[model samples]
Target: MIHGCRAIKRADCFHSKGHRNPCRSSSNPYMILFGAVEIAFSQIPDFDQIWWLSIVAAAMSFTYATIGLSLGIAQTVANGGFRGSLTGVSVAAGVSPAQKVWRSLQAFGDISFAYSYAYILIEIQDTIRAPPPSEAAVMKRATMVSVATTTFFYMMCGCLGYAAFGAAAPDNLLTGFGFYEPFWLLDVANAAIVVHLVGAYQVFVQPLFAFVEARAAARWPGSRFLAREVRVGPFALSVFRLTWRTAFVCLTTVAAMLLPFFGDVVGLLGAISFWPLTVYFPVEMYIKQHGVRRWSTRWVCLQTLSAACFLVSVAGAVGSTAGVVGAVKLHRPFSGY
Candidate 1:
């Protein structure tokens, strides 16, 4: 209890130091509660398909990261481990100080932004390895290249989607592929998403497994015989081998099966998870690593920019009101019902 209290106090001190107004710091949670209602109210739709809009944004976000962000992460910390991974990885991956990344993430909070946090770990691991200015410059170039690529794709896709569907495109993306054969395109998109979701899990589920396995290994002394005997490796692969993974797959399946039942809600849940990492914590880290005294005008601009991103994220999350408006236009609602 005493330790926990100290940790909290330390965290508070860190937040206070970063900004003149810590409370004003934009965060994802604060957005969901505050904006979702107002945005929902304002975006009241009758001619637009709100649900589809939400999905579009979700896809673009994924596109930006998967194609570029993923590369950025790999380049940043290809050989890095959590925490200390950032110094070398950031240089490799194209990031600046923990403080800089913190500024860049000024948008909606999410795990994507936070995981880059492995940079702080770098500092924790070693003072000497903390990145130099030259390393920081390299990272900036990588980010620029990735952002340009991502932006092009995002705009083209969004535009294609809009043109292909006219009024219908937002509700159905496949329409972009074949406006004349939207049904088939829609079916294809649906099938592809099924495969994508399965693949997404395969891609995403590993970290959790490793985390559990590491814990199990740490306690191996308590069950040395079994630990040594089992080559199945880490956190009862059995849990995921059948039930948990299948259950997870099934939940998405069921949601899709009952798209009318809970699809939009699930997306909201998935998207919102990014908040804790991106919006709040990045700022939290920036302040802690460098006091307000250390910040430059450029850093201040970037930090403010990230906060705007957070607001846009809030708009995206809550703008489902806007999303629903789109659905009403389609009269084939995807969500926001």
Candidate 2:
């Protein structure tokens, strides 16, 4: 529409040789998503196909997430083994888990999955460090309760999605909520989740940062990098080099995972990885390294409580993994691509 707008200066192109920006990019994915939605609605006569399409899409999503995550885990564990292997195969397979986690989550299948040991470590760093057995016990319980609440919320959201738009998934998923229920309330809920998404993205970034910084520190043991101080043009900057782009990548990756559901991805990922990385690995590693001494009743109780949480979390992960795997196998080839 702006193309036709003129103050009789058509010859004076906006790019008059000094400044030019043919801004073709649209910052809003929701616009593109809704446009396709309008087209789909036009092309279809009714909403009868909603459930079938949903089942297929959801299955595809489920499969991609678990396989991607497990494969990623395999790669991480593999690297932990052959960190210094000399073979070319080792050289080529030496891609670190940091990039892998982001790239894997970016995949359509694993779009909702984000699990890295680094992520887990950052998640429970403070909790794991608590010296008090009771403190650790509370942390474990909190995580359990959080997961349960998130799952229940996602279940409700799934029902809402199914009802509002049938099997039709939208990039702006919450749009359907406005259609099926109260639009105002859905908008508020939607806003709240976007805020939470930002928080979750921070969770992802810490691990990515750690992975990069660890490599840098290894390469430059006594040099100025990562945590070292550095001088800049007008001020000092941390060698960490953390910037808005890094934060954006982390948040956007997570935001992308959430496109089809706007929120279910959070619950799914939380269920799958939150425990394995945070509680299971930390406790097991700590115990294996430090030995779970029967030094004090409090310590014993902490270990026992953590153990119970780990068991339940493992169940959740296994159940989710199976669902994802089975869903992928059941899906028709080329579906949800």
Tens digit per residue, CA lDDT, model 1, 162-249: 3333323322232112122223323334344433333333333434434445666577646644234222334232332233334544
**Candidate 2 lDDT score relative to the true structure:** 0.40
What's the CA error at residue 22 for candidate 2, in Å?
Answer: 24
Per-candidate Cα RMSD to the true structure, in Å, reads 21.9, 20.5
Candidate 1 segments whose C-alpha is farther than 4 A from its true place: 1-144, 175-178, 181-195, 216-221, 224-263, 283-296, 321-337
1-337, model 2: which lDDT tens digit per residue?
0111110112123224222423232223432343333332222212232334334433433342333233333434544532222221121354455433332332322222432333443335343445666655766686676566545544444333334333232323432221222333333434443333333433444444545656777998877545555565665555354342344454543344234232234435655665566556666677667666665675677678677755555444444444445445554432211
Compare the candidates by TM-score and give the number of the best one.
Answer: 1
Model 2 TM-score is 0.40
Q: Report the poorest 10 consecutive residues by lDDT, candidate 2.
A: 1-10
Best by lDDT: 2
Q: What's model 1's lDDT at 130?
A: 39
What TM-score do all the candidates reach, one by one?
0.43, 0.40
Indicate the residue-level lDDT of 331 in model 1. Answer: 41
